[model samples]
Target: MHQWRTWHRPLVLFAAAMAVMTVVSGVGLLVDDRVLTGAAIWSKPFKFAVSFVVYALALAWMLTLVTRGRRTGWWAGTVVALSSFAEMAIITAQVVRGKRSHFNHATPFDESLFNAMAVTVVVLWAGTLLIAILLLRARIADRASAWAIRSGVSLALVGAGFGFLMTQPTKEQRAAGNLDTADVIGAHAVGVPDGGPSMPLTGWSTTGGDLRIPHFVGMHALQLLPLFLLAVTALAPRFVRLRDPRVRLRLVQVASGAYAAVTALVTWQALRGRPLIHPDGATLTAAALTLAATAAGTYGALRTGSGAHTSPSAEKELVS
Candidate 1:
C-alpha cells in the first residue's frame, strides 16, 4: 500500500518469475541424471530461460526507479543483471557444446572468468544495497515506507550476492588445481584430493572451507528482518516532532546489530570447522535475532499505535 504504485508491478513480476524458476530448478534436481539422455542440453535450457526472465525483470524494476531519481541505482542494478545474464549464457553455451563439467571446467570456465563474474555480481548487488540505503538517507520517500523498501532491497541483494559467490570455484581450490568441474556437485563426490569437501553441499565446500556458505545464509536474513522492522515502524504512532529521529535511530540500531551478529555467528561457525549447510548453533542464533527483532518491532509499533488512540486529549489542549 505504501507507494506500491512506484515499483509494484516489476517487483511482483520478478517475484513470480523467481518462484516459477525455483520450482523448475527444483524439479530438474529430481530428474535422475542417468535418465536424461541429453541432460545438459535439456536441463540447461530451463536455467537459461529463467536467466533471461530475471534479466528482463531486473531491468523493469530499475525502470520503476526513474520516478524516484535513482539513476545510479538503476545503472548499478542493470550491470548486475547483465553480469548474471553473462554467467548464465556462458553456462548454457558450455552445455550446448556438450561440456560435461559445465560449472567447474578448467578450460573455458577458468578462474579469471569466474573471478570477473563473481566480482561484478557481488559489487553490483552490494551496490543495490547501498542505493537502497541511500534512498532512505536522501529522504526521497516517506520514512516508514523507505525503511521497509530499503530493508527488502538489502535482503534480496544480499541473498543474490552470496548466491553468485557460491557458484564460483574457491581461491584455494583453484590454486591447488583441485577445483570441481561442475557448477553444482552432488553430495556423494569425493572431497578435494588434498583436503577439500568431497562434494558441495548446498553450495558449501568442504575442501577450501571458505566462508561462502555462511555468508550466503546470513545474507538471506536481510529480507525478513528489515521488512519486519519497517512494518513495525510504519504502524507506530506518528511522533509530532521527533518521530523521524526516533525511527532512524532504531533502524540504525537494528540494522547494525543484525549485520554484526550475523557476521560474527557465520564467521565463528565457519572458523570452528562447521559446514554452512548444516544447521548449527550459530545459524540458529542468527535466526533467533532476526525473529526477535521482528517481534520487538511489531510490539513497539502496537504500543505506539495504542498510545496514539489516547492522545486526543493532548491534541485538544494543544489546539486550545
Candidate 2:
C-alpha cells in the first residue's frame, strides 16, 4: 500500500478513475449502434476517457521530477485534472445528445458547449505547458531520464500546437463557404470532407489525409519517450554489453529526434492532403533519410561504447 501510494499521485489516481470510466464507456460502445457523424456516439467518450488516462499518467510522472515546489506540482495537477474532466463531461454529454462534440455550433446550446470545451482545452494546454517548463528547468540526477523527460514535454508542446491547427477551417471547408453556414467551422480531416469513410475503430480518414493522426502521435510523446527510455534501461543489460550511461542517453536522444521528425513529416503529409499509407516519393525519401540517420546515430553510440569500461555505479543506475 505504501508503494502504491508512492507511485500513484493525485494525477495517477485521476488516471485510474479515467481508466475505469473508459472501460465502462467502451462497454457502452458495444451496445450502442446509433451513429453520429459517421461514427458511434459512444466513441467520443471512450476515446476521451482513454486519452485522459494517458494525460493523467504523464502529468503524474512529470510531477515526480520536481524536487522543490511540490505544492505547485499538486496545484498544476489539480487544475489539469479538473479541466480534463470538464472537457470529457462536455464531450460525453454531447455524445448522449447524439451530436458531434467538436466543431458543431449548429444550436445555441451546442455552441456554448463547444466554446466551453475550447476554453477548457486552452486552459489544459496552458497548464501542461507550465508543467513542461518546470520539468525542463528541474535538475534531475539521471542524465538519460532527464533527457527523456525534457524531450517528451517539448514534443508534447508541439503536439498541443497541432490541436490549435485542427481548430482552423480546412481548405475544403473554406472553399465550400462552410465558415458562413456552420456555427463552428473546423474539421479533423484534411484533404477529404469530414465524416467520410474512416478506418475501423480509430475513425481516421481512409480516403484522405487526417490531421488528427499527427496530433495523436505527437501528443503521446509525453508517454512514449519516457517509457522507451525505461524499457531501454531495463533491457540493455541482458541483451547487450554496451553499458555506458552516456551511450544510453545518446540513443534516447536520437530516438526522440526521430520521433519528432516523423511527427512533422506526417503533419506535412496531412496538410498536403496525402494519406499516411499512400506516401509520395518525397515522403518516402524523407522517411528513409530519417530512419538512416537514427540508425547511424545508434551505430555510432554502440561503436563509441565498444571499448569503454562501464563503471559499477553507472551499471547499477542503468539496471535500476
Best by TM-score: 2
Please identify model 1 stretches exceeding 4 Å from their true place.
1-20, 32-68, 92-105, 109-116, 119-123, 126-130, 140-144, 151-212, 229-256, 276-320
- Give the range where candidate 1 is weakest over 10 consecutive residues by summed lDDT: 185-194
Clash count, predicted structure 2: 0
lDDT to native, each model = 0.48, 0.82
Candidate 2 local lDDT, residue 297: 86
Q: Candidate 2 lDDT, tens digit per residue, 1-320?
A: 23345542667877887898898889889998999878887887888788889878877867877777767767877888888888888988887788888988798898889889999999888888888877877879878888888898888878877888878887767777757667667888887888888888789887788888888888899999999988887887785643577678888888899999999999988888888778899899999999999999888876766786778886677645
CA error at residue 208 for candidate 1, angstroms: 9.6
Give the C-alpha miss distance for residue 49 in model 2, angstroms. 1.3
The sequence of per-residue lDDT tens digits that candidate 1 reaches over residues 1-320 is: 35545653533454455557556655655662432222323354464455446434543443454445466655655564555556554554544455532234346555455456556566656656655654555542344444544554555555454454345444445665645564432111122322244233243445434454445445444445445555555654665422333444355455645664565566555555455556477568777877798568645643443444335554343323
> What TM-scores do the predictions have?
0.54, 0.93
Off by over 4 Å in 2: 1-4, 178-180, 313-320
